[model samples]
Target chain A: MKLIDRARMKSPWVLHYNSGSCNGCDIEIFACMTPMYDLERFGIVNVGNPKHADVLLVTGPVTYRGARVLRNLYEQMPSPKAVVAVGTCACSGGVFRNCYNCIGGVDKVIPVDVYVPGCAAKPEAIIEGVLMAVERMSEHTPLKRGK
Target chain B: MAVKTILPFGPQHPVLPEPIQLRITLEDENIGQVLPALGYVHRGIEKAGENNDYPLNVFLVERICGICSATHGLAYCLAVERLLGIEPPPRANYLRVVWAELHRLHSHLLWWGLLADAFGFESLFMQIWRVREMVMDVLEKTAGNRVIISVNAIGGVRRDLSEEQISEMLHTLEECEKQLYALLPVMLNDYTVKKRTAGKGVLTSEQALRLGVVGPTLRASGVAQDLRMTGYAAYGELGFEPIVEQGGDCYARAVVRARECFQTIELVRRALQQLPDGDILTKPRGNPNGKAIVRVEAPRGELMYFVVGNGTKNLERMRVRTPTLANVPALLEMLPGAEFADIPVITLSIDPCISCTER
Candidate 1:
C-alpha cells in the first residue's frame, strides 16, 4: 500500500552468493543478467554489497564455512527481504548432500522464500524464482523494529 | 617513506564470480606482498568421490566446475577406463572431441567477456557474451543442458550427435565464427583494451616454467605446451598446434584464449568430418583395481585426475588437480610489483575458478 514499496516491487536489487557451488549455477545466474536473457529488463540488478540488496540469490550447497557467512549476509540485508535458493544444490543439497563438508542446502542456515530446482538451475528458472521472491516480498509484512 | 595497508580482496567481490580471499599488503599503491586464503567454496567432492560408485562419480566430477565440466568427466572416465583396461569406441572418441572443443569455445568466450568487463569495456563484454550464446545454444541442442552437459559416462559419452545435429552445429559454429571475427579486432587492437592489458602483469617465460603454470597462462608466456598434444580422446587424430604468445601480460593471455577459440572451432569441424560409425560406449567390464593417472586439456589448461580403485564400487581415492590451482602460484608471482588497480585484470587473466581449485 506504500509508494516506496510499490517502486521496490518494480526494481529488486539482488545480491548473489555462491555458498559453495560448482560454478554451474553461478554462471547461469550471470547469464540471466547478460544481453541474452536480460533479466535486467525487469529492473533486477546484481549488487555486490548486502546492505543495498532487496533479494538474496543463493547458489550451491552450503559448505561448512559458507553457512556462517550466508547467515551474516541474511542478517545484513534490511527487512522486507526475500531469499531465493537457485539450484538443486541450494534447494536440497542435490548431489552434494552426502559430501562430508556440506551442510546441505541454504535453508539449513536461513529461511528460503523460493526454491529454483535444476542441476544448474537454468537462467529462465532463476528469472522466475526472482520474480516469485519479489511477489512474496509484496504480500509479507516486514519484521517490527526492536522486537 | 611508504605507507603500508592491507586490502582484502574477496571471499565475495564484484570482480570475482567465486569466493577466494587474497590478502594484499600494499606499500603506497604498489602491492608489496600477497597471501591467498582458500577453502571458502570447498564442498569436499574428492572425499565424496570415495563413497560413490565409479559410474556415479562421473556426474560428481562434472559438477566440479561448470565451464570445464566435460573435461573433468573425461579425465575421470579416462582414468577409470585405463584402470579397467578398456577404451571407448572410436566414434565416442570423436564425439568427445566435438563436445570438448565446444566447451573450450564457450569457456573462452565466457572468459573473454569477463576480461572485457574487468577493463571497464562494458559494450565489448556484452558483444562477446552475445556471440557466446550461439555456442551455448549448440551445446543445448546437442546435449540436453546448457551448463554441466553431463554427457560423459564411465566408458564413453552418454549422448551421441546425429547427422542432422552435426550439420546444425556446423552451421551454428560458422555463424559464431563470423560474429567472433568481427569482434576480434576490438579485443585484439582496441585502444582501451590494449592500454589496460598491454605491459600489465608481465610474466616471463622462465617465470612461467619455474612456476609450473599450465594452459593459456603458460602459453601466453611463450611456452607451447598443451596436454592435447598427448593424443587423449581423438586429439592426435585431429592434429593442431598450441597457440602461443610471448608478451606474458594480460593482453597476451587474452590473445591466446581468443586465438584458441578459433582453433577449437576448426577442430570441431575436423572431428565431425572424421567421425566414424560405431558404438558410443564399450560397457566397461569389472571394477577398477589399481591406480591410474589421467590428464586432459581443459579450457583453462591441463586438468589431471588421479584415481585409485580397489575392485569395489567405490573408488579408494580421487584427487583432481585443476588448472586454477596451478595458476594461483603464477598469480602470486605476478602480483607483488603491480599497481592496486591492475589486480583484477591480472587475476582475471589467469581465469581463476576457485570452485575448481577448492573442490
Candidate 2:
C-alpha cells in the first residue's frame, strides 16, 4: 500500500447529502458522530465542501430534483472517492419507492460502494458502511493525472 | 451607497441537516430580501398515502418526519379513528402521551445541539447529543426502533410498555434531567450564544400571528398557542400548558425549546402515573367512510392530517400541513434587515425541517 493510501485509510473525510429522505437516517448519521458512536475515532470528519470530501455519504431515496444535485455532488468530489448509501430508502427507495417524485435509491443516480439498509440505519451500521467505503477507496485506482 | 450582492445558501450547507436553498439579496452585510427555494426533499408521501390502505398509511405518515414519527402516526390514527367512529382505549391514549413526550425531548435536544453547532460550539453540541442518546435508548427499548419508532397503529399502539420498562424510563429521565440542567447555563447565558441569538432575528408577536407561525417559533414570539393544549390523544387528561416567551428572537426560541424539554419530561412522568390498565387497541369495525381532520402537536408545532375516506381500503386523499411550512413565511419576515452571518442561526432557530415541509 502506498504511503498516501495508508494515510487516507487512517482519515477519511465524509460529505453528507440528503437526497430526498425522511430525516430519520439523517439524524442517525449525526448520532454516529456523537461521543457514543464517534465515527471520528476512525479519523472521519464531516466536511461541508464536496471538493474536500473523500467519501460521499448520502441518505434517502433520490427524488427527481435531488437526483440532479446528487450527481453534481458526486462528480465534484476528487477521484478515489467512494459513495456509501445509508438507509433502506437510499438502498431501495424504502416506503417512498412508489411515490411520484421519488426516483428510488442512491444507486439510480450514482454508484454506491457500500449500502447500509435500515428504515433509519442505526449509527453502528453507518460506521460499518463508512469503513467499507474506505476499503473501496483503497482498491480504487486513482484517476489518471492528465485524463 | 452599499453594494448589493446575492448570496445563495444551501440545498446543501453545513448548518442545515436537511436541504433548503435561500436566495439572499444583501446590501453590504445586511439582508435586503430573501427568497427560499424548497422541494429539494419532496417525496410526495401524501400522494403515496392515497393509494395505500388506511392501516398501511400509518407507516407512510410516520416517515414524513423521523424526529416526530410518533406524533405523525398518532395524528393519522386519530383521523382514521374519527372516520371509522372508534377510539383507542384510554390506556393507549396515556401511552401515546408517553411516547410523544419522549419524542419531543429527543427532538428538542437534537435541535439544541444543532443550534449550538450553528454558533460553532462543538463541545456543547457533543454534550447535548450525549444526553439525548439516553432518550433515544428509552425510545428504542419501548418502541423497538430509535429514530422512526413504529409504535402507532391505525387503532392503537403496536406494543405496550412493561412495568420494568416504565421504571427504567423514569430512571433514565432523571439522568437526562440532571445532565440537561447542567447545560442549561450554557444554552441560556453563554455570552457567545446570547450575542449570536438574542435580538438577532426579532419576530414580533403581531408579525408571528400575521405570518401564521406555529409551535415554538410562534410561542417564542409571545403567542400562547400550542395544539397540545387542545388535549389531543391523552393531553387533555394531563395538566398541559403552552411554553411561551416574549423575546421574539433566536434566544427566545432556544429558551422556549429548552424549557419545553423539562416540561415534556414532567408530562411523561404524569402520564406513567395516570396510565390505566386496559387494551391498547380497539379494532375498527369497517373501512373509514368519512372525511376527518386531526391536528396534533408535533415536536415542531401543529401537524394536521386530513384524511378523506371513501368507504374503501384506500383513502381518497391524505393532506399534511407541517409546522415548518407555516413558519417559512415567518422566516422570510425575520430575514430582511438581519446580517447575512445571522441567516443560518435564524433559519435553524425556526427548526426548519425541509423534508417535512415539502412532503
Candidate 3:
C-alpha cells in the first residue's frame, strides 16, 4: 500500500518519442494534453529531453531502421524510467507489423511497462495507460547493487 | 580520418505528419545535403490495377493517399474519360466542382492544422481541427467517408447532391467561413506566427518557374499559374481566378492558402447557386488504346497524372508527378542558405505529403 502510494505521489514526467508512425498516435497524444483530458494536472509534462523523463511514451511500430535509434533514446533516459507503448502499432506493430520495412513492436527491443491499445488510441485510453504504468511502478523495488 | 555523420530526419520527425526519411549530411547543424528515401508504406496499388476492372479502379485509386484520395481518383478518371471522348453530364460536372472545392477547403484546413503543429502553435492546431471537423461532418453526411470519398467514377460521380443537402452544405460553408474569417486575423495578423513564418523560405517567381514549382507555391511567388486556369472540371462554368501573392516567402504561401480558402468557399456557393439537373454518370465505353496526361490543381499545387492503356484490362503505365517532389529541389535550395532554426517552418510552408510524393 505504501509502495503504490509512493508511486502515485512521485508523478513521473513523460517524454514522447515517435519511432516511425503515422501522425495519428502523435496527434492523439497532444489531444491528451488539451483541457478535456489535461494529463498535466497530474504533473505529467512532456519534456523535450529524455534524460529528464521518468516515463518514455513511445508511439508507432519501431521500424527496421528506427530500432537502433529507439534503443539509444531508451538508454538515454535516467534509471527508474518506465516505457509505455502507446497505440497498437507501438505495442504490437498494428497494421504495419508484418510489412517488409517494419521491425515489429517496441517490445521486440525494450521492456514495455504498459500497453495502450487503440488504432490511434484515444486520449482517455492514454491517460489510463499512464495510471497503469504508475501502478506498475509502485510494485517494483529498486535493484540491489550487484543484482 | 573523420567519418561523415548521416542524420535520419524522419520516418518519424516532429514536424512532418507522414513518414519520410531524409538522409541529411550535416556539418555541425547546418545541413550540407539531403537525400530523400521513400516507399515505407507502398501498398502496391499500381500493380493492383491489373486485377481490378476499370470501373472498380476508381475506388482503388482513391486509397492511394488518405488526404488527397478523391483528387487521385478524379485525376485518373478524368484521364480515362477523356480517352473515351465523353463529357460528364452537366449535373455531374457541377457536383464534381462542388465536391472538389469542398475537398480543397478541408485539405487546406488540415494543412493549416499541420502547419500550426509543426511550428509548435498548439492552440491554433486545435482550433483548425475543430473547424476541419465541421467540414468532415459535411463530407461524411454527403459522401459517406470521413477521408476517402469514393464518389468519382469514370464518367461522372456516383451520387447526386439533393437540394436539401446542397442547402445544408451551403449553410455549413457560411458558418465555416465565419469561423475562418475570425481565424484569419489570428493566423495572419498575429505577432508570433508572422515572426516565425514571414520573409522565410523565399522562392522568387524566377526560382519557382525554373524549379517547376506549381500550385500555391508558384502563386505565392507572384506567378498566375493555376491549372484551374485551363478549366478542366466545372471551374470554367463557375468562374474564379487563381489567387496569387507577390511576397514569394512563407508568408506569401500562407496568404495564397488563406485567399484560396475564401475562393473555394465562393466556388462552392457558386456551384450550388446554378447547379443544373441531370443523370450523374454514363457507362464507360472501354477503350484499350487510350492515353492521356491530365493536370489538376491539388491543394498542394499542380498534380499531373499520365496514364496509358494498352487495349488490355490493365494500364501500360500510371505515372504521377506530385507537387511535393517538384518543390523538394526548391526546398533544398532554400534550406542551404537559411539558418538552421528556420528548417521546420520553411519545410512546413511547402506543405509536403511524403506519402503522395513517395507513391
lDDT of 2 by residue, A1-147 (tens): 366766877899999999998899999999999998999999999999999999999999899998888999999998889999999999999999999999999988999899999988999999999999898777764522223
> Which is the winner by lDDT between candidate 2 and candidate 3?
2
- Every candidate's DockQ is 0.82, 0.84, 0.14
lDDT of prediction 3: 0.77
Residues B208-257, candidate 3: write the lDDT tens digits. 88998877888999999888888887888777798989999998888889
List model 1 lDDT by residue over B1-359, tens digit each: 99999999988888898888899999999998999998888999999999998899999999999889989988999999999999899999999999989999999999999899887899998899999999999999999999999888878888998889999999999999999999999999999999999999999999999989999999999999999998999999898788999999999999999999999999999999999999999998889999999889999998999999999989999999999999999999999999999999999999998899999
Local accuracy of candidate 3 as per-residue lDDT tens digits, A1-147: 446445544677787776655545665676566555678888777665667777888876776666776787789887666889988778897655545566768899999999998755767889989877866765563422224
Label model 1 with its docking quality class: high
Segments of candidate 3 deviating more than 4 angstroms: A1-147, B1-7, B25-31
Q: Quick one: ranking by lDDT, best first?
A: 1, 2, 3
Q: For model 1, what is the alpha-carbon lDDT of residue B298?
A: 93
Off by over 4 Å in 1: A141-147
* Higher-ranked by DockQ: 1 or 2: 2
User: Cα deviation of B207 in candidate 1 (Å)?
Assistant: 0.6
**What DockQ does model 2 achieve?**
0.84
Give the Cα lDDT of each candidate: 0.92, 0.92, 0.77
- Per-residue lDDT of B142 in model 1: 91
